[model samples]
Target: MTTHSLIVTGLAAGYGDSDILHDLDLTVPAGKITAIVGANACGKSTLLRAMSRLLKPRAGQVLLDGKSVHKTSPKELARTLGLLPQSPIAPEGITVADLVSRGRHPHQGLFGRWTREDDEAVRAALDVTKTGDIAERNVDELSGGQRQRVWIAMALAQETEVLLLDEPTTFLDINHQIEVLDLMTDLNQTRGTTIAMVLHDLNLAARYADYLIAMTAGRVHVSGSPETVLTEDNVRQVFGLESRVIADPTSGRPIMLPLGRHHVTQA
Candidate 1:
């Protein structure tokens, strides 16, 4: 890893009076993919926002490279950390290349002029995301999966060491979800990018993540390798759903099969 990235301690954040998160401590290993999973409203998105410096912590601190994130300049921070929220907006007429090029804003100078490095980064990001063929295409005209990939490409162009994503698989079908995760895995392996993503799909999380953090009601329920933390008992406790976790025949990692009421057999 080029840099030892984010360290968060006693981190608590939320909007207005209601406290969505209690004290939290987490250390993200550089260059590894960490997946955060939980039921809805478990502070998954808020945790990502806090680490990315979008949401202010009420009690504890989020440190990026040993420095307080609150003290870090936005441009400098942007250079080190990139975040992709669930749904990012592009201007109506924005081209894929134009939007991806905007990731270089952090690298710009006083006049914010574009540089060769910026152009190269944009092109490289497009190429890596496989959107180079559609570089001139309007972003609004793309499919949900393609649009998501474009947003990811824009984040990639920033060339940050640590990338955070919230619900990266929300709108996609099963195949595209796998596609995005595969792309992210490739990026992590190829560039040594440290990644932390919040995922709603437990199965996908287990399949793709190097590490998993299971959260419940704003606190970490358990964290470790998927095989360690994603057992049937843990799933029942954290997600409040009965499930049977078995080894995936292909991968050997944990695989959750939820047991719904309708699926229960009569005695």
Candidate 2:
């Protein structure tokens, strides 16, 4: 498995005339799981869009292995870096197999034909995501969890060294959230794929991410290991909430317990 480096420098991006990310800089650790967390409207999704080249940066650049992502050709970039956005829409009435097969487009030449290799890639992705049984079903017919897995399977079939996700767990229940995150972990561990994701749940981010990046007002507040970044002070600073940080017994990672006004325990 090959690992790739993704770096951002002086990134400033937004929609229309407003900048959601300002002079941001970051380096995604190679072959590790990174979670970007912050409060609502903190530019988490905007940062991800910039990194994935979905949103153009007004300043600086996103570099993949020292090359500018914005300068890379669409086919070449998609071959190397795969992105699953927050809400991926499939063509109405498309079957699971057909939608996943689209992932092979980057690998296929303009005049190329679909070969056995493509079939194997799709099959492996479906197997890994456990979506093979529903391959013939319409994407619109599946439940939310199943639909999310199918989208992930499409990304997996792309076989990129780097994968970026935007709030992959949004709209998922607790059980499904864990299921999706565990699937991502499996991809990271088994394929050595570099994973960067935006997550809203601080506890889940700390539990699963090897690195944590906390953003505020379109800038990174702090970033490091979960143990280093998920502190009481950091949470207070980043989320503006009083919270307790404790070691999770099962994973030995930090778990944040938010303190609210109703909880009447004076410190």
Candidate 1: worst 10 consecutive residues by lDDT? 258-267
Per-residue lDDT for 247 in model 2?
95
Tell me each candidate's TM-score: 0.97, 0.97
Best by lDDT: 2
Clashes of each: 0, 0
1-267: candidate 1 lDDT, tens digit per residue: 586668888888899997788898888878899999998999999999988889988989999889988789988999999999977889999999999988888999989887889989998899889999999999989999899989999999999989999999998988889989999999999999999999989988999998999998888889889999899889988988888888999998889988888856631
lDDT, candidate 1, at 223: 89
Q: lDDT of each model, Cα atoms only?
A: 0.90, 0.94
Superposed Cα deviation of residue 70, candidate 2 (Å): 0.6
Give residue 218's error in model 2 in angstroms.
0.7
lDDT of 2: 0.94
Candidate 2, after superposition: displacement of residue 51 in Å?
Answer: 0.9
Model 2, range 34-112, lDDT digits (tens) per residue?
9999999999999988888889999999999999999998899999999999888899999999999998989998875
